[model samples]
Target: GYNSHSVLSILMQTYMDSSTVLAPVPSFWGLVNSAWNLCAIGKRQSPIDIETTHMIFDPHLTPLRLNTGGRKMYGTMYNTGKHVSLRPDKTHLVNISGGPLGYSYRLEEVRLHFGSEDALGSEHLLNGQGFPGEVRCKT
Candidate 1:
């Protein structure tokens, strides 16, 4: 009915206006990307590197923070761009923190993407390189 289309239009507008609702930002994506790398390297590739492993505690739905190990390694600077991308998160690593750990990255959220034949359609390109997948990492 007309109500269904109207509701869909509102939802679509809201999603377009609110970026976070669609995808998690740098911290979440970055850590996920790193973890994916490890999973792909190892023999398992089983569960596709669980996203909850990197989940960070948040009281107000805050974005998860990541521990960069006090360094700019992993090129964390580009994480934000990936968040806006329409691709599966393939993070490869998630550094744990403790009482005396350096910086940290918290898990934010997990986003799924699909297209014709599940083809990923994303806006951000890495080094002008398009990928079927991407992970947004941040500190």
Candidate 2:
């Protein structure tokens, strides 16, 4: 029997190895591992294309508030072979409120994605255009 941690460890180890030839593609991620089933079949996934013309602006929307306690943040960055990730230290409390959010949310992790070329890096596309890099913040 395999646990979630073990499965993650195996996935991480396999992904970290550049020489591995059996790496699964995006469409096959869920088929190869039960833990990643959502990757293959999930209806609501991330990194979707954003069409600016479809965006609606609401004047009632308030400005988002970021509370950092006026202190510098410290975090450890890691290169996971696929992307760069930053996990903030627990001692650094960063929170965000207002805007469209109903409650205050704490900062969790940040991910950066880039490619060797200028037109091939971003995870999300804007008007069918890709950028050199993209930064994603997860909370």
Candidate 3:
């Protein structure tokens, strides 16, 4: 659930500081192209009928933690960076619900960062939706 731009904004305190990080995960057009490609991959015909996904943003008012696996993740890591090294976060619980769309989670800590490379890149897809090479992490 680290994709909260609002929280990122708060953690950053300003957009000026935000740019120092990286580009937005998944360029909008990239996912569109990927979706179309994936949809046609196993299809019997040329163009295929694919279901589309929409971007949804909501206010993140709750704070949570990570799980046991997440804790072990933090236990073994490298602390070499210009900033404070963030580790695998434990999951904490939230009373609020994801309202059928999302699942309520807890805040244990923060799992460093994982992807093919950096924040601008990741290893998963949103139901096969890939706007760009970059992505967000939420589990």
Candidate 4:
């Protein structure tokens, strides 16, 4: 299977060689909102440190369920320069529900990101450490 991020990065590198150089790609440290002076602001920004001691267990919460209905999903990979985004086929959507969600939500797009090395590329850090990679799914 192809790693979308890797493919996108290669595409971006090729583009960079031909076009006028662009600013740094939007990343976990500097997102599009602040970089472009956009009005949208993230209230709950990521890459925060989540300590296990601060977590609370809720016994009543149901486990999250992902129902694809046995249908095959097709999508295209995009090289946004900042990230490798996935645009799914509008016809077949994945249904995700449960846990604290009140209704099932359909997946929109999925973005994948990774570090230059295997040890440091996660948007969310647990106790101040990065993971090998991360998948940012939009729903």
Candidate 5:
């Protein structure tokens, strides 16, 4: 188990290193254009604009359940230039269910994004207003 952990750590670090070196540098406008194009082209893109007026509130929606309480969650932290992220152990996957979700979901990782200013750095917007930071949990 120790050997596997060590191997995973090393492999992840290597992958990160290679990815950072190989990733292309894009300007703000270029990034925006690419995202817009992807949103227009892709059928299943995320981070879509959520219009509060069209949002339907269901009283019967159950609260989401996370199975991380009362147990230790082992993970490793890494920096990905723009944000700090945590890579959780695969063996100890987080179980999530409830809400509008039809089935259980397993949390893979988590990322934190922050900006030096209050007007920038959020990955998602709330009615077109940006926040200083946000936390994203991947499942």
Candidate 6:
């Protein structure tokens, strides 16, 4: 059985392959495939429009704690075509908790995205601006 991540990866790959021939626009992503319906209709998608005026700070939020067993961790890095990914070894358990999170989470993967120019790269926008690159962590 395939996990949700695997299924999503397959769907994304299929979309990428088909888009080369179809040239479907971003708005038509969901229309091109049922599995990617969220790409068109999802409210909390990537490249989010972050407005600084709407920002609110929570003073009660605690700092995040990373438990690395007080030792070094080893991981393998891979170029997934879309981005660079790092998957840590299972022997070294890295767990994170606190920081507004209700439960502790393990670091599953780390993804890095960058572009040739500074205008386009980040996954999300900051006050309607784009950064040169971004690092995403999957937990």
TM-score each candidate.
0.22, 0.64, 0.22, 0.61, 0.63, 0.65
Encode model 2's per-residue lDDT on 1-139: one tens digit a residue: 3222221110110121242233344556678666668768978655666566766565777887768789888889999987899988889877655674445666666778777876566777666766777777656
Q: Which candidate number maximizes TM-score?
A: 6
lDDT of each: 0.31, 0.62, 0.29, 0.56, 0.55, 0.61
- Clashing residue pairs in candidate 4 (N, C-alpha, C atoms within 3 angstroms): none
| Per-prediction tally of clashes | 27, 0, 24, 0, 0, 0
lDDT of 4 by residue, 1-139 (tens): 3343343221011111222233332232235334423213445534455555665576889987767789887888997876688877877777656774445666667778776865566565555555656776656
The TM-score ranking, best first, is 6, 2, 5, 4, 1, 3
In model 4, the runs with Cα more than 4 Å from the true position are: 1-44
The count of backbone overlaps in candidate 2 is 0
Report the CA-based lDDT of candidate 5 relative to the real structure: 0.55
Q: In model 4, what is the error at residue 97, expressed in angstroms?
A: 0.7
| Candidate 5 Cα errors over 4 Å, as ranges | 1-44
Error of 6 at 130 (Å): 0.7
Ten-residue region with minimum lDDT total, candidate 4: 8-17
Q: Which residue pairs collide, candidate 6? A: none
Query: Can you write out model 1's per-residue Cα lDDT over 1-139, one digit (the tens) per residue?
Result: 1222111110010111232224433234335566335433565432232234364454544333445446543312223433442221335343323332223334333332222321243223222323343333221
What count of clashes does model 4 give? 0
